[model samples]
Target chain A: MELLVASAIGVIMAAGVYLLLRARTLPVVLGLTLVTYAVNLFLFVTGRLTVDQAPVLNQGHESFADPLPQALVLTAIVISFGMTAVIVVMALKSYVESDSDHVDLDPQDDGEADS
Target chain B: MNHWIILPLLLPALVAPLIALAVRHDIVLQRIFSVSSTVILLVLGAILMGSTASDPVQSYHLGNWIAPFGIVLVLDRLSAMLLVLTAGLGLAVLLYAINGWDAEGRHFHPLFQFQLMGINGAFLTGDLFNLFVFFEVLLIASYGLMVHAGGAARMKAGVQYVTINLVGSGLFLIGVGLIYSVTGTLNMAHLATEVGRVDAADRALLEIGGLLLLLVFAVKAALVPVQFWLPGTYANAPPPVAALFAIMTKVGAYAIIRVYTLIFGDDAGASANLAGPWLLPAALVTMVIGMAGVLAARRLGEAVAFAVIGSMGTLLAAVSVFTQEAMAAALYYLLHSTIAGGALFLIVDLVNQRRTGYTDWLRAAPPFVHTGFIAALFLLGAMAMTGMPPLSGFIGKLLVLDGVRESSYAVWIWGLILGTSLLAIVGFARAGTTVFWKSAAVGGYLEPARPLAPALPFVAVGILLGASIVLTAFAGPVTVYLDTVAEQIYNPSGYIETVLPTSGHPEGVRP
Candidate 1:
């Protein structure tokens, strides 16, 4: 189980990095989403992998899984969701305004400089 | 249990939503409420600073819950000082914005309030995850403000800024997770004690987590190798928004000081001073590159952006020494640079608003109506930024230099700082001559196509510059207070004791 989770995180992060390096805005947005997924998974695993164990106290049970990481991961998920939404809208706005999807602004297109 | 400790965070949080919901369409009402709240915040901040001066540390636990379990807001000399600075800057920027900058976009008042809430929260929170939450709050609000005046340049800069910060936030979460997995606590006070007790086998993981966290802060601080996003973002932002952002980099510096000394100080076993060796060299390189950017900048706003970067490098280099005196100097420099950098941004906008052609570009264009007054303001701002005498910048640099004189890197520090000051002076001189002096020499001066900017904005900038002068005039008492703040930071026992009274067993320890 541990090996599976680690490999999954690695694969997701690799994909995220590859997409993040792309010059297009949409790919970059997608890349951030992928990286956030990896991060959320990593945060979840911080409580350690436990099967059939309650996060809450159970009578007659010697141990239960730590619950703090679960709460943290949940909060992180919601925050990342909001962030992803904001970035997507921003990318769309930039694309519509500039008529280009490339992430870097062309020097000539800088309005203040040209003005 | 002081309830007032949470006021800084609460006032803005509550006021923001009220402005968004209740007075969204009423610009007059929004302005009235926003300005009043900011004034109240400044007064509260002053009171907090005065109270914390003698007491040194105060903690407020949420909902009567104990430390390490419930959310905690800890106010010390450091947080109080920053709170007051933020409120002062926010008021100045908000007042300036009311001169029609807020009308450029929707929800300006609410977003401004939200940004303040995030900044205050980040400064006051005692937990790592809470800090992350506040960072998101600020970043989101900043995204709205950056593109508030919606132009192609702003949208492009906003996209890049958001993407880079998202990645940094990811790293922050991973680092916090790893630390929590090992130490089982996110409360900074508890982490301070628990980090020292980590087992030898887990020390490597702990170090990796700590360094990763530092990397996160380095990105925020615009430290070298991770600072590419700052110039574009700052230059593209609206002047008033950019002025508020002058404190944002200092937030990163504040976090570095707070976390490094509290949790990863000289006593954190193998993680002791993990960032110490690398910080100074990186800071020097940051200084050199930032000054280079300033010299190469083609526009006045871009030059101010690079100057901000340069100031950060200087401040961080002093902090890297990790001595109490050096920390005091760093704090003093931090306060001075924020005000000066903020004033410079506002002055650039004022210049941009007045020019008939090639606005804000470092070229010989026709002079505006208030050329002499604007020129003098720019000169004083530039002098302060470049560390000239009779301004706070010189005093800050002297204090930092004096503090680091005993360190092994003293020679390098002195050399780089002095050389950079010379470069900054030359850059500002060239810019000033091109923009102001040579412009008057141009024949056939044309009347400005636009009316002159209101005197209110100039008054706002003057207030900021006046504050810097006051900082210089009161350098003795201010430095003494910062000395005590630095002392409290270096010795975290008082902080920990206030946050967590029981040392051996924290309140929220899970069996």
Candidate 2:
């Protein structure tokens, strides 16, 4: 179970990082979303993997999962969800405004870079 | 629980939603509420700073829960000082904005208020997770503000800015998780106690987490390697918003100081002094890179933005030394740079607004309207930024130099700091000559020969520059106060005991 969760996080994070380095906005947005997922999962497992254990109090349960990480994960998910939405909207705006999805300004348009 | 401690956060939190929902259509009402709230915040911040000055550390437990299990807001001298600075800077920028910049976008007032709330909350919160949440609050609000008066260039830069921060936030969560998994508490005060108890085997994990968190803060502080996003974001952001953002990097610097001093300070056993080795070198490089960018910058705004990065470099280098005197010096530099950088940004915008076609592009255009006044403001700003005599910048640099004089890296610190100041002067001088002096030889005034901009913008810029002068004039008393603040920071036993009373310690983690 640990290996499964750990590998999943590693693979997703690796892919997210690769996509993040791309030159366009859409992939970067997708990359950010992917990284958020990996982070949420990583945060979730910080409590140590406890299967069949509840996060809440219940009768006769001998042990329980640490609920704090779950709470932390929920917050992370919401923030990342909202942020992804924001970046998507922003990416769409950039696409419409610049007529291109490239992440940087056109070489000549940025005066500081050229000079 | 003195409720006044929480008012700085609550004032902005309440007013932002009110402005957003009720006064959405009424820009006049929105400005009135926003400015009044900010003024109230400044007053509240002053009161809080005064209250904390001679007193012991204070903590506010949300929902009346005790420390380890519940979220907390801790108030010491450092947070109080930052709260005041944020409010003052926010008010100045808002004043400049209402002079015409706010009307260019929707919800500018509410977003500005939210930004303030986030900044204040970040300063005050004592929990690691809460800090992350407040960071998201500020970054999200900043995203909206970054593209507020949206242009293609602005939106593009906004995209890059949002993406980078999103990744930084991810790293922050990972760091927090790693730390929490090892220590089983997110309360910074509690973490300080728990970090000392970690086993040798788990020490590696804790260190990784610490360094990861440093990377995140370094990103915010715009330390080298992660410093790339700042120039684009600041140069493209609306000038007033950029000015307000002068406090934003300090948030990162503040976090670094807080976490390093409180959690990972001299008492953290194996994790002690974790940041110093890494932070010092990165900061030196950040200074060099920033000043070089200043020299290379073709636009006035970009040059100022690079100067901000350089200032952060200096501020964080002082912080990295981790002595009471150096920390105090860093705090002084922090105040000076925030005001000076902010004043410079406002002046850049004034130049941008008045010029006809040249729009802050550091070219020899005809003399723009009010060239003399803006030129004079730029001269003072340049003098302040380049560490010349009498202004707070020179005093700040000198204090930092003196503060770090005993360190083994003193030679490198002095060489880099002095070298970069020279670079900054040349950069600012060139831009100043081209934009202000060279315009004299161009024969004619800018076309259409516009009259002066509104007095409010000058007033806003004047207030900031005046603050710098005050900082310079009162350097003695201010440093005296900050020295105590620094003393409190390095010796954080007061902070921990206040946040976690003896009974407040929860059970240790099962791991």
Candidate 3:
């Protein structure tokens, strides 16, 4: 189970990095989303992998899983969702207005850069 | 148990939702509520500053939970000082925004309040995970504020800013995850104790985690090699928003100070000074790069943006020394640079508003209306920004130089700081003369540019510039206060004891 989770995170991060380096805005947004998924997994695993252990204490139980990382991951997921939404709208606006999804401003035209 | 420490966070957190829900469309009502909350925050911040000055360290655990278990908000001298600074900048920028700039966008008031909540929470958080959460809160609000008055340039910049910071946030999570995995705790005081007692076999992992955390802060601080996103984002942001962003970089510096001093200081077994060797060189290079950007910039706003980057470089270079005196000097510079940078941005906006064709471009265009008044303000702002004598910038540079006199790299620090100050002066002088003086020589008359930028905006800029003067005039008392703040940070035992009282042993003791 540990190996599976680690490999999944690695692969997701690899793909995210590849997409993030692209010159276009849409791919970059997608790349960021993918990377965030990997981050969430990493955060979740910080509490260690426990299949049957309860996150809450039972009077008779000797041990329970760490619950803090779970809470942290849930909060992270919600925040990332909001951030992705904002980025998507921003990318769409830029695409529609500039008619080019290229991320960098046009270097040849300084006046148009301001506009 | 002190409730005032939490007010800075709670006031903004409550008021932001209220504005969005009830006064979302009423600009007047939104202004009233936002301004009132910010004023209250300023008073609370001042009160906390005074109280913390005497006691030096206070912690408030949520819901009566014990330390190292529940969330905690720590208020020390450093956090209190930063709270006051954030409130001051927030109120000033909001006042400037109220002068018709708020009408350009929807939900401006709510977004502003949310941004404040994020900044204050970042300062007060005693847990690493909580810090990451506040960072997101601030970044999200910043995204909304960045593109507030939507234009193609703003949208493009906003896309880049959001993407870069999202990537940074991912890195932040990885960093926090690594630390939590190694230390088994996220409360900063507990982590400090754990780090000092980690097993020898785990030292390598702990070092990696520490470096990763430093990487996260470097991105936020706009340290070189990861600082490419700041210039465009700051330049394209609405002027008032850009002014408020002057405090954002300081958040990165603050994190570096808090985490490094508390968790990775001299006593952290293998992680001691993990970032120390690289910090100084990176800061120096960042300073050089930022100044070069300032020289190359074509627009006034871009120049100011680069100057901000330069100021961060200078501030961080002093802080990277990690001595109490150096930290004190860095804090003084931090306060000065925040106000000076914000003042410059506001002046640029005022100039941009009045100039018809040239806008804020640094070219000899037809003479702008109210050139004389704007020129004087611009000159004062430029002097403050470039470390000219008789302003806070000069005093800040002098203090940093004096503080770093004993370092091994004192020669390099001195040479780089002086060289960069020279470069900054030349850049500002050329830009100022071109915009204000050369234009007059070529056009010889004030063309009725746009009626004049309204008086209220000038008043806003004056208030900020006035604060810079106060910072200069009161440098002695401010330095004395920051000296105490730095002393408290360097000696983290008091902070650890306050936050984790249940751990009977002092901070460095292993359980």
Q: Which candidate is the best by DockQ?
A: 1
Pairs in clash, predicted candidate 1 = none
Looking at model 2, residue A107 earns an lDDT score of 68
Native contact fraction, candidates in order: 0.78, 0.79, 0.69
lDDT of 1: 0.91
- Candidate 2 residue-wise lDDT, A1-115, digit = tens: 8999999999999999999999998888888988999999999999999887876756687678888899999999999999999999999998999999999876644333121
Q: Where is the poorest 10-residue window by lDDT in model 2 chain B?
A: B445-454
lDDT of 1 by residue, B1-511 (tens): 6888899888989999999999999999999999999999999999999889678899999987888888999999999999999999999999889988898899999999999999999999999999999998998999999999899879999999999999999999999998998898999999998888888888888888888888889988999978899999999899899999999999999989998999999778778888888788989999998888889888899899999999999999999999999999999999999999999999998888878667788878777777889899999999999999999999999999999998999999999999998888899999888888987787555466666555789889999999999999999999998999899888898899899866454734442
Candidate 2: CAPRI quality band: medium
For each candidate, what TM-score against the reference?
0.98, 0.98, 0.96
The lDDT per prediction is 0.91, 0.91, 0.88
CA displacement after TM-score superposition, residue B254 of candidate 3 (Å) = 0.4
The DockQ for candidate 2, computed on C-alphas, is: 0.57
Docking level of model 3: medium
lDDT-superior candidate, 2 or 3: 2
Q: What's the DockQ for every one of the candidates?
A: 0.65, 0.57, 0.57
Candidate 3: RMSD over Cα atoms?
A: 2.2
Off by over 4 Å in 1: A58-60, A109-115, B507-511
